[model samples]
Target: MLKTIFPAALILCLSAPVLRAQDLPDYVGSGQCAACHEAESQSWQGSHHQLAWTEPTADTVVADFDGTRFQNDDLTVAFSKDAAGYHAQITESDGTTTMRRVHSVAGIEPLQQYLFETEPGRLQSFDVVWDSEEKRWYHLYPDQSLPVGDGLHWAGPYKNWNARCAECHATGYEKNYDPATRSYASTQAEIGVGCEACHGPGSAHIDWAETGKPVEIPGVDAFGLTMRSTADSEGWIQQCAGCHSRREAFGDGNPVPGTPYHDAYRLMMLTPDLYFPDGQIREEVYVYGSFLQSKMYANGVSCMNCHNPHTAQLVAEGNAVCTQCHSEAGNTEFPSLPIADYDTPEHHFHEPGSEGAQCKNCHMPTQTYMGVDARADHSFRIPRPDLTPITGAPDACTNCHQDQTPEWAAQQIEAWYPDSDKRGPHFGTVFAQSAVDPAGALPDLLKIAGDEGQSDIARATAMYLMGAAADQQTARATAPLLRDDSPLLRAAAIRPQRAAPPQEQFQNLLDLLSDPIRLVRLSAAPDLLRAPVASLPPRIAERFGRVAGEWQRSLGNRLDFPETHLVLGGTALTMRNTPAAIGAFREAVTQDPQLLDAWVMLVRLEASVNGAEAANAVVEEALQANPGQPDLMAMQRELQQ
Candidate 1:
């Protein structure tokens, strides 16, 4: 059964417009840009961005496809190339063998993942990937033995190319999902991340070039470009962060190239799931969130300062990257940087050529992801072994010295730099302490939230945690932040107020419905759902309705995601629509059987509305899907009783 929860009218209104090649009229493609910019085109020829996604071809496909068999647990995939194309013969544990043609190849250097079309218009990234460096095949998740129906399976909802990856990997992409049919007719102007991905559509630029490069125009931009290179440091950083950061999209597909970061997406803060309490990269969070915590970002440094935007490589190799600004001959671009010798043995307290003396080894430690890809932390933090014991966060010092305790590392650091002012109160201590003693941590959290010196992301994180104990004190502390200049802070301030009274929620959040930033309006709209719209002024009621519609449209855009169905189920329950709620929850569990909460909700609704027989059936199905799960087992026992 296709459990389509959304109404036909709503889906039609909110669905992404069907965008084909002709629909993207302004997009002249990357080849158009190459005619005028030869140097940049040459640099980007084989760069990671250019090869992010490509059609599988002889030159493009680097994996061994000459009848090679790779085994992982009970699954064996035979790779071979025929006259037709690259093919994978996957043998499942249940003794079913399926032949799938390779539809596309993703990435290049460290690891390359192959995509296979599982169903019509649905491409799934295969779990088995090619390790380019070692020239071998390996499973991305080696430990897990996922069944065909599992959410984490290669062909499951979570690994769907249209929903999860297409926008980032391709240029001018649109995920045209039809909820009625639950299928994708996804389209992209270019196959891989191209010159137009960063610079916006190139038709106007080409026109400007052919017309003798006019200095001024009545309606067109000076250069006929959408995104200007003359933007400030923060502008440039946000442009890159649009794709690099871990974030939630506002609507279907990617936003236009020049859209402000907050307007297009909501950035994930320093949450424990994605980051260590001290704001170190704990997962594959890319670089934006960590970089936001750095002194380099605070001091007006951007991605182009250290990395060549064309090649996606560091401007200088090794310690020379840091010495560009940190050395005695400081960089002219950043005159505010103090001239200092940081690349010597005296500063590092290690042999000049040793690993310990490397700037990145101490400050920007690397964490491996995707089996073979090693990504570095971009926080550019000074080593602080002293706080590791208190915050339970990893320190760079003890990371290299596995045998030594954090206390031992702290003592060594103290001996080397006894008068270090860097050893001060850290937000990580407050965040860690909040887990065991939230009451004790509240005052410190309040202080951190209001601290101007702290990074905006860190401050926003502090505000988000205080929502767990949303009391009068928390409400009062966060009230001022609602008016903060930063959209991140303003959006985060809405979270702690979720527990406030209906009237309070109305009074506090009504103004934010019309906030200039889309993220802030989206954050505030849900909490204001309980507002007294009926008795309110006509203008106020209209404002609430408009913002609520925006929120629903945002939800509609991501209906392809199973987690979005969970949100829909909850929202339906809040509206007292039992049947709609049941339908949404059923859809959620149907799409991804591992959603325990959705199953529980569906069972409870069925019991209340349809009787114990229906509820018991749901329980049995959940138990079958998630075998021996304690919560589901308990539910099954309860149903049997």
Candidate 2:
């Protein structure tokens, strides 16, 4: 949703840097690099990186923005030419200053960014992104209806790059926006993610090359020329992960490429906002967070391993890319007998050339985010048709055939994969059904929790669902995962046993009190309080008290905007902070009143504290927001009964 643009004079008009006899870093822009590295540059130029941000000139702008007026709701938005460049006049539902300058255009066919000058040299993200293929301008946050003058409206502070986007989009960018002075000064080494971004700063490397002197560079080859990502040298991989991850930036962009990931960006742990009860992509957690949870990343695979960094092309053609790792004779280290005729109807049960046969169409399914941009999940998961009916996640079959049901997909899968026992049951399916039929799935969920063969994500999911199961066996099964290296897995482990021995649970949660993941640390907070205070380690109890105090200080801060509050709230509840838990639920409702969990939690909180009358009012408001939600209707029936 972040849109970036360098000053036109600063971008297209800048003189190309002179390359000396010494091979300088590929600063000649991707075009000049294309001369010798033709194949690589060609692929790079066609990639999302090359087109990340572009000018809307006739040569670059593929969409029909020329005098086009797209109407939405009661508004008429028209893009036309001006002396400065292109401009748009949006006449909204209520009449106001209907014109704004279009400082930059984001993309071509798929999505277009409209830029607004917030301050001198400061451009912010706009909620309205034009989908050229669809030929419409839809809201980026389609779930919420913004008031005309609200800050979250198309023109708002939350969407601005100074706070939200500068770190990722531009190279060596600094976000130095001072609220008190109402002044701003930020710098980018080059607009868009330039060569130096992944390569690290070229000053030292360029100097070493010119002088013909040896220099040390962290996570680089001996020649100081290339990045190294041998399992032993994954430090460089963390550099690429900075922008690619779903994480929070620490300090003011001080951490450079060689800096450890934990030092610069705190990776997000699995939360319900960015994922379902099962670890499937929900909101845009970016690639790194979800990808790290994959068997691929854990087994030494990397982003550049599949994607050609220079050209941005797949290493091999289409499904062939997958064959390198998942071959007939699988890689010796992680062996699995490849199923025969995987490319044919015998395996996929679809026509050979159809999209259904594509490996990514099933495993790396696309989640259309930012309205127009469809980000394919990099997590290579087996398609789970059974989860489709319970959770609203799109199954591979229904994704292709929208009119078909999950039952239809399940039937088709059974027809081809006749031996259903070959494929394992889905964690998503088990968790979804547990919300309704806890008794039936409780034993299976416990088995999944302790199944070392299952994915860590699947195991974590099993642990989380077992909280509602309220069984001693499930609690015992999940205890070991609290020590998991992945904070996501650890956070999930905390959920199942809130009512257990306070001393053991408190000691276990205490060790992770300072966990690098925000969600993990957040989760530990409520559990510390829920435990008998005396049972907690004195140091951990103090830390929990401090974190709670900080949460109180930032009481008005809405976790809902980040879309990770559901997970954060769950963590807070586990720790036993009713006010923070209530606030989180309140923010969720404020953002989207139709969220049934928010209503249900709010009602539960009210019933636990104030009484049934207060709980009923919250439920009434939720019903008004979403009249047809069966879950809310069921909750209402339970309360009355």
Candidate 3:
């Protein structure tokens, strides 16, 4: 029998009645393993993974509840603890002070967020947060006073714990959302990320440990879990990207541990929405996408090499973690890495033991999100200070030396190493120039997209930008990528065929309708929708309609955000369902009143369906909120005439 160490605190937290895997379902609670795998379980005790989310008990609750009132802009929130539980008095956008009970606590250390169940299975994390280190309550968006009905509001869908946060925070979490009913029957085997969250369902593994019988579940590994599915480094990294990367999931999204990333979720590329042109972290990209761009990733580096997965901590603290592999003599594991004194002033250009001497300071720059959450970029690119003014991407040099300009930083680097290959023209400058004038940068983008020497992700992103102002040349540049093995490139190639005739585009994109990846199939939907359906063979048209329906359903499933509804409205227009388009546009403006495009579409729809009078009313309404808007003003003049 494996001796398991169960701390008194861990035992108390695990006292809740759970749905045992053997009795009712697949997930055995994490607590069930304490008697067997003691060391691993004990090692995980009090880890960030273990405490990501917890029931708001006295010991677990780190915030002060001594009737403290914190004011953020116009709103004043009062936190108090009663006999029943911890509660907050929050003033709504409509000026109603409502009492909300704290249902659960999320995060620890620098900050802690409280979850409130506004409705059954519709839990929302209140915007007001407790800064544990500061010992004070502060709004998550201290500077921005978002109104109550806004999606970014604490009570709105964006902050909903089930859809946004639950998947990663808990084990065996089934969102179980019903789009038809607008409700959630959300269930989790154990609250907070647990043993099964990473290792997969533990019933067969536990049985094997106790009875010395290996469960012969097909596809199950020797540990009796569906893990270690592939021996390659990329396959293992997919296990981490499932949660770590910002992505869109397909189907039920109940991905088993080690499920192939494409089989489970569509990993987002370096889209302009998430990252800067240079592939530096510009938003709340957790880490995976940035890490994929690193030279380290190219040379066979992995998360497990530097961090312990169980404890969720660095394997070694400070610079020592990096020195293990990046020593003076490049190890056999990384024969390509040149021999260099990484720790000395020769490489770092900083005094030994200074903040700038840290490997991460020079390589992995930091970007802050969610107010207090500062995460370091994992791309590990050498700082190109020269690209700062050109591309608007932050460089590591100016990040530390706030007063100095990027020009000065670049000059200093050139001064330090006159012949250093690190200081060279980079993709950042190209991406920045492309964003400003896509026509001007088309040649560079084409070169980057076709070159195998460049990062495939950067290549794919260039193809994505190619969709704007695409010509015959752009089509020629991207046509071959449709059959590329990488789905990212395959999906991106479909968008840049503007000059090609509709039939030609349909012909090029037809086979991708049957592409194995859901994202690839979905990407082909719009172009296929333009097919001469009446002229196609009966069987081909049927298949086309089927794929189109699947793509529409995929769009419908993600109507939680205004962005999705915006897409829904555009798709509806393409399908020639004017009423559906109108409804979707209305929903979008309801979520975000300032969405000028939605309002413009509404005006266009009203003019077509009803009359100029109806269109004029919408235009006037848009101008009231967004006065002097050129598009609306133009419409108003046309309607008046």
Candidate 4:
């Protein structure tokens, strides 16, 4: 029954509008939660989660709507409010004016961004943001130029709320995306991240509450409607990280709060694009990715330890937050851990009231995103003044003392902790070096991967980076990790298998097809499917078909994005389904006209079927939209020859 229901539910998620919480569903809405836990509900009222997504109204909308003009280069966006609703006239680079209706708002305080419904069930976050504190409008990416037709454009698939932003912002969001129509009827239990979003669906709990029944067993502390785990378990952390971490959802739909993270999404490691090689926040990755790397996490520090789950505010202000666990007395739960005097000048090397005196100032630091939004690095670590000079990652010492040099900070650090273990050469130095020169860093990364002392994440990242220079030596080194205890490590190890022959790959990925982790099994599906299934044993072929179907469904769930279509096209090409490949490529270009590779592939496929004239016309149309695009130009030149 469960197996039959799961696939039927998937079809329902694909075709139907989402079921409301009130419709006898497990999710009974935050209002129901407020009836019993008013204190928690009230504390969460105006928190960031509550305001993550709010209906656009005179009260909710923070941006100026009184004919305010924000100019970026030649393009001008004029924001105004009227009886119809808040609207904006956006003039494009190529002298085209578009009227965008303000559908909803995202964020508050530091900055508020408006969302425009560019297409049905698709919300595009406006490029311009309102600086609520400064009382001014500014371009979110003032330094970067994203042209009108590009995928990164405000109207493009990258900014679509249905595919990218909605799940995190809303409660019980069902991204009802139709692969057939490329539309969404996406619905949520509540507009914002409500109580049910964390505590799980409430109907069952409410039933037990009214009847005075036991919601917990002798050892288990699970609520009747909550996830099937207790506070003591890692269930809550996994739930929070579902949205908080930088991850890729496999279109599993809205998950129950207690669902294992690997079952729903593929957690991204400390990749170079998102994090500095030294593991400081480089991009706007929210928080959980870095938090996973912290010693606090290693010592059982969950989000609730520092933050109020209700208000989402720090449990204490200033250094007091750090002092909770980092004091000489230390936390009773973690007595074996070393403690420090974080607030004093001896520890911080600054006056008590100075910015450098703060624990986070030296350790967490910050990176600014959305112009005014500054997020702290959650990977709490000791101030690496030692690595600043080596890796060029910002040290807390140099950040506050802008006048002082990194060498001076290093001198002062060495003077205090002359025999400090922290003063030694770090793996981050190796990680940073690899990003710039993979050939030089591969040997060092291999050493990091083999070392048992290093954290699993660090070792996993090392194995991942080997893809840059996946030579025979690197492949040999990574082969051992294919059977590592950590699934994250095994996933990295499988990267080198791309260099092997089809028969070898079939054998290599066969065991992984039945791996416990969904991430490993699905990742292996495409590779195993690359070889002809007829060549394999009947049972193995059956497993391949089942896994491949699930994998393709996951891809189809994200069909609103052109990149997913590109993946589908590649998969179709492997199976020699030329029509399917052409259709997938066509869908890719339809969603994102400036998707260069999709157009090139479409042209190549079209040339084989409809001759060069048809392919030339396709290239000509693409060239008109994206003038002087090097890849498309090269394709056109090749076709002419």
Which number leads on lDDT?
A: 1
TM per candidate: 0.95, 0.69, 0.90, 0.90
Q: Can you write out model 3's per-residue Cα lDDT over 176-249, one digit (the tens) per residue?
A: 66654668888888888888887778887877788887577765676677665344677767777878888886
Candidate 2, lDDT over the whole model: 0.62
| Better TM-score candidate (1, 4) | 1
* Candidate 4 colliding pairs: none
Per residue, candidate 1 scores C-alpha lDDT tens digits across 1-641 of 00122233332235433223233327878888887999999999999999999999998999999999999677999999988999999998778899999999999989999999888888899999999999999999889988889988888998999999989999988888888888989888898999988877777677778886753523235676556656787878988998899999876776767668998899998888888888888999989999999999988999998999899899999999889899999988878998889999879998898999999999999989998999999999998888888877889988889999989999998998899888898999898877778777888888998999999999999988885676776876688899999999999988877666657766888789889999999998766654444466668667766776677778888888888888778766665678778888888888899999999998899889988889899898898999999987887778788
Q: State the C-alpha lDDT per candidate.
A: 0.84, 0.62, 0.77, 0.78
Instruction: Compose the digit string of candidate 4's lDDT tens values, residues 1-641.
Output: 21221232222223222223333336777888888899999999999889989988877888788989989785799989889999999998778999998889997879988898887777788888899999999887777677786778888888888889888989888887777776778888788889888777777677677888766532213347546544563667888889998888876356666566776788787887888878898998888878878887877878888889889899999888988888887899887778866568887777888787778878889988888888999988777877876677888787877999988988888898888888666789998888788888888988998887777778888877867586766766677778888777887777766765656656777888788887888778776656543555568666765666676666656778788778878876766668878888888888888888899898998899899989999999889878899888988998899
Off by over 4 Å in 3: 1-25, 210-214, 229-231, 538-546, 590-594, 616-641
Task: Give per-residue CA lDDT, model 2, range 486-586, as digits (tens).
Answer: 66577778877674676667667776667766556656655555565534446654666555443332221222132444544564565465766786677
Q: What is the lDDT of residue 586 in candidate 3?
A: 85
TM-score of model 3 vs. true structure? 0.90
Q: For all the candidates, what are their Cα RMSDs to the real structure?
A: 3.3, 10.1, 8.8, 4.3
Q: Please identify model 1 stretches exceeding 4 Å from their true place.
A: 1-25, 213-220
Span of 10 residues, lowest total lDDT, candidate 1: 1-10
The alpha-carbon lDDT assigned to residue 338 of candidate 1 equals 82
